[model samples]
Target chain A: MTESVLASWREGPVKQAIVDFVALATTPGPGFVAVADRIATFDNDGTLWVEQPLPPQFDFVFRRWAQEIKQDPSLAEQQPYKAIIARDPAFFAGVATQDPEVVGALLAAFARTWKGTTPEEFDAQVREWLQTVKQPKLGVPYIELVYKPMLELLDLLRAHEFRVFVCSGGGRDFMRVFAEETWGIFKENVIGTAAEYRYADGRIVRAEHALGSLNVGPGKPEHIFAQTGRLPALAGGNADVDIEMLEAARFSVLVSHDDEEREFAYTSGGEASLARAKELGWTVVSMKDDWITVF
Target chain B: MTESVLASWREGPVKQAIVDFVALATTPGPGFVAVADRIATFDNDGTLWVEQPLPPQFDFVFRRWAQEIKQDPSLAEQQPYKAIIARDPAFFAGVATQDPEVVGALLAAFARTWKGTTPEEFDAQVREWLQTVKQPKLGVPYIELVYKPMLELLDLLRAHEFRVFVCSGGGRDFMRVFAEETWGIFKENVIGTAAEYRYADGRIVRAEHALGSLNVGPGKPEHIFAQTGRLPALAGGNADVDIEMLEAARFSVLVSHDDEEREFAYTSGGEASLARAKELGWTVVSMKDDWITVF
Candidate 1:
């Protein structure tokens, strides 16, 4: 047989489930949704790209923080900087999995450090950082590590007329910088944790506090509904932070990073979500067995 | 010769300016913006529909508040309810014109009254209100008051691949109720002042607070950039609250309510915007002189 477009996904129940859901969602019948309501939201980190060792956003922001600390060593005395200086695993883990308190601390640090910068200025910095920094363990640019099977699934959804979006706990502007280029999705399709912005003297400048709560469990659906006036029809995610968003959708697919040989194997913060997925009949994708290729 | 599609607009500089801008934006040249960058935003109240005497959103919410006060006379002691009971013109004017403090009070009242309702419940209430309530002065449904000329302008913009959005100082949910059916734009295209929503027990519910700051003045461009990551290439508005958003665009149009015969004539809240339009050399549409029809 000719190679399936989803060649990276092995011929198994995981791949078949994805194909069947799209068929039912697109077919004209009781299961079919209207074109306007065909919103598909995916979590950014593990859902679409590798989140092992550290989520890409943290690598981006943490490096910026490290650079700022180099310029002014006294800043290293502060909470987040000090936590980084001490190398607190708990703090890092909390943010990686999107714990509200830990992420709130990082958000506060972001607001304080990036205050007074325009969106263009902040975006330039992110672009510059992406060009230079490599994913620590993989030794490649972070954008190069996007999951191949997930990209195929995004293509499949788009072919069926799904308006796909990335709903993540990572910074909204950060993801937006690479959304159109890396994911082949519209730049406006990203909904994530946001910073407060102020407009003055013709430029929209970033403010110190985040716009609202971080885009975690409940915040995901809240931001989705607030922006689009609808919950996602299809949702893909891989962590506890993504549970509520997955639950809110008509279809849920959770990615299990169970391939230690090809990718990191630990669930980290996804144990609860995996259990919940089993409890609820949400489809689970096994990286080790379901995917023939990891990246 | 065939009649122009924008027949509502009389042959004048105002009409020519709009046509010229769209042409330049679509033509492949230095002035030609990519289709992805062709964002057109319009204010909802006076820019899209009739807002004389009182804006329609207040009429909807105020009527509901009035009914609640009747059921519980204690509610009449509250500030917004008390002002409405007393027919306070200053309070109404401040809100219609989008005064930050005055609008903030009304938003606070909304949060207090509507907390714990899901998006579905709030939308149902708004849809029900639209069904029963008619614009008081016009004695017709509020949606019927949308300007024919403005609708023509929206259609022309969309024909040129412009993504038209309604960014209003009104409540987001209130506008979303009829956005798709009345405006022929996606419901997600409506961005307005937002209510904080909390997700719990398999349903996302509204909270007792507005999300972030009120969407007025600078909040307009802030919300636009936050949602779309780009500012408007073209914008239309008719009030002082819209001055900042109008100033941020490449082309700006301000509608002058100078037609008393066909429509109400008033610039109570639009005085500053009209002045800014003159100072900035922005196009000004005389409802009396430019339009062949009022509705």
Candidate 2:
């Protein structure tokens, strides 16, 4: 017998579903998907990696906001910056709940951090940040916090000729910096929300505003179609923002953050998605029940 | 000796440069790009197919506009639609010159024709159009009108493990319908101008306005970087619209439509690009001199 590709995953329904899907896709059978059509997409923040305490991207942006506030001092008076600097738990809770005003403030700050830099320069800044900063709760670099079982699943999908894509609500260019090294997914396959870019002085530079809709909620399917021109054959996510993306796929997998001891537990933002997964017969993988390892 | 991959291309400086570039990229040596970084972008219209008389996309749109005008004659009074309906040579001349007003009007009309349709429906319509609509001058279906030499070059690039992408000024969703069958490039690999999409009532629908910048001139590199997160390693184009795309690439190839007898001749729009190619020491493949076949 062939050794299991997702050895980190416990042998059960979740692992069985994944293996069965791969077999249906790869083997000579009635429902076999052609190699070109075997596209799989995974949500980045809470799905592929840890998003506990706060999203790693938001942490990165908050640190930059702190630096900006330190320089300008007056920036702390700004609506969002004031809340951020005050360490208001209510403000952080708003972000956790994905409240519109809070989310908009976060996106605005995120956009401003890398606005004028060329892609190369932005990438260098991200690399520098990755080297120096560690996740507050995980006590490791953000990249190292990615789930081991999920990484194995990505490899399993690739070995079966499925073209894997990292679909994220995080910054597109930001994800590209580590996607190739950490995820083994090519930069071209990383689709996410992007700031507008302009060509000036013989190089492309990120503009001050976003190019289009954020790659979350219904926007996920729209962006996916715009970039890849196909609905994913398989999709994975762990949050409400990813519900539409999962629904668009033929097979949907929802990762449940039910492991409090090994990994942080969360049922707040993803409640609706978790409920939908149950109603739709989508596979729900329990981190505590189905996985033996984290990171 | 192995037969040349680009046999349809004449043995000349242009052909030699391509072969040499592929060799350098594929062989283990200094400046050898790994397969992961071997990204090659191509302009669609005249570079890959016959774009003379009118761009095939314009032809597709104009036909739709005519149908729309027939249903509602008042549409014929609209600024651009009026010009298109009259077949005014000056209007076409303005388009050839890329007059901003004329081009904006054209894009607006193009966007409206397929707005509100699902991608699958848009694709089905495009497939139907391809079956019926033949290039006016060439008298062959648009798919078959693709350049034979360019097809050979694409195959050659793929053989060297270069990931080929069609970066076009045409509609992205429109091109995806034919890219797989016509260019042997996958749908995911074709990046082009895109309309905004909305998710409504469980299906993704094309929205009225463009999602971002038009993929022409400086917009090409901006869109390319936005989607792929990398500057193309190699690029090919045939017009001023493609100038910046070619400029952004490590190696640039300009296809000069200097052949009048076999293929339509055009030195008008592409003259500056042709001149820049010479000044920058970029490869210029003459349709008259280099290609033994056009389609």
Candidate 3:
């Protein structure tokens, strides 16, 4: 393979489809229709942005929660709030997002903190937070911890007219606040978990709820279809939660978090969803072998 | 005036900003930085796609209604359903999109005709319809009837990296489906009026209720805030309804549909909003004076 093809392999489907699709789309005969259609879906946490111990939004929220408790001190005595105040990682490990009440409350708190903030303000806030907030072990900005290869992949797809969307398991609106500035991605296109809203003083407000399910696994595709009627022609993800989204497309790939030296060698808890991805004809991207850079 | 600026003047505000924003975006040094920071917002109807003599979607609905009426004449005896059966232009004119009952019934009928259809099926149906569908007076494919100068503007904006978005009064999702193919604009960047949704039997269903107010006139700014949370540095629209959106921007312009001989010369029935846009310091685009071509 040429250096371009080698680079293409690392980037995933768009590069691979270019030549063939170009020929088909631009067939010389009359009645030749060129849709030039290229839709690419990305998993937000690990695929587009960073997701180390957990997704970055969760990390942000955890820190925010910790700060809230730091101010009150009494919150440390409550059940879930106590765990949040204590910064007890063990306490968080058992918490299930599927509990509608818990998720709803958290979602509400998140919406209050971020909603109605203009894009400029939000971008500045995201930039400042990413700069100051360091991953505990790595001692670098959280933004610096994003997968570099995936960033390259995003550019590669955009260059080929592939519209990129983040069908994440994260909060839908949270991604909107930062995606544009961090990755040049837009907010309207990022589909994740849905939240309830209310109207107050002639303005719409996202209501805080303590119960909701984390949009993951099956929910990725569900949210994607509900928000954007277009199924991606190409897609990528790091876990099995992304399989449904990938399966909905003509092209699919999974970024194997296997290179400990360059990045994190990790899996979500016990189940190895990446293994199942390979079994489904999805390309397994080995970080060590495939990437020249891994942020 | 420069050749480029003069060319832009004819295209309308939506088109002008694209050219100006793109030029500044690609220019070297501080010029690019200053210009790239300019956010350009576009109206979706006549401003982006073809919506004169009613939106392209209304044509589809009308056609479907006509077909159904031919099959079942008894349907003509109903109220709004009767209007649909008769293909009555007046009923379409009174399209009460905000009323849940009206929207629900229409959306149900629309879903019945469109759902479970593959992307291929949808696109083919649209393309075939486009071949015959024409502006009642203009007598041309709606796609072929797109404003050429506006198209040049879009290309110009993309060249600059100026963040562009479609903030319109039309359906939020429908704009996304054809925007990429029509303007080479990404789907995520488009924001418009929204509809509610429901999940049933492993399939997503469109709810008949309006998700929010029709994003027009004053509501344009509201939608932009809800979707992007950014007051556009630059924005454009074609009618009195677009005044609020254009006026809200730092650099704003209004496209006056005054050139009857070239394009269709007509005005939407409403209070004169373009006057307000002008008083608010928006640049007024004279269709007759500014454009060399009207697609």
Best by lDDT: 1
The local lDDT score (0 to 100) that residue A71 gets in candidate 2 is 93
- The reply for model 1, stretches above 4 Å from the true place, is A1-5, A96-104, B1-4, B96-104
Model 3 CAPRI rating: incorrect
The lowest-lDDT stretch of 10 consecutive residues in candidate 1 chain A is A95-104
**lDDT of each candidate versus the true structure:** 0.87, 0.86, 0.63
* DockQ of every candidate: 0.76, 0.80, 0.17
Question: What ranking of all candidate models by TM-score puts the best one first?
Answer: 2, 1, 3
TM-scores, in order shown? 0.95, 0.96, 0.76
Angstrom error of the Cα, residue A186, model 2: value is 0.8
Model 3 residue A126 lDDT?
Answer: 60
**Which of the predicted structures, 1 or 2, would earn the higher lDDT when compared with the native?**
1
For residues A1-295, what per-residue lDDT tens digits would candidate 2 score against the true structure? 1676788988898899889988987888877888878889999998998887778877777788889999999989875899977878888767545688887887677666777788778788888888888877668888888999999999999988889999988888889999988999889999888888898667988787877877888878888888888889999999998999999888899999999888888798899999999999999999999997887
Q: List model 1 lDDT by residue over B91-207, tens digit each.
A: 877864667777777877887779898777888888888788887677888878899999999999998899999999888888988888888987778899898888888888888
Q: Which of the two, 2 or 3, has more DockQ?
A: 2
Query: Which pairs clash (backbone N, Cα, C closer than 3 Å) in model 2?
Result: none
**Candidate 3 lDDT, B1-295, residue by residue in tens:** 2466446354455445545644654567544545434567888666755567777766865787778767887766765567665667665555532455555566666665555554446556666676777778788777777777667666555555667888877666666666777777666567777655444343445544555566765667766655554567677777766766776776666677777786666667423656675466666666687777777
lDDT of 3: 0.63
Report iRMS values in order.
1.1, 1.1, 5.4
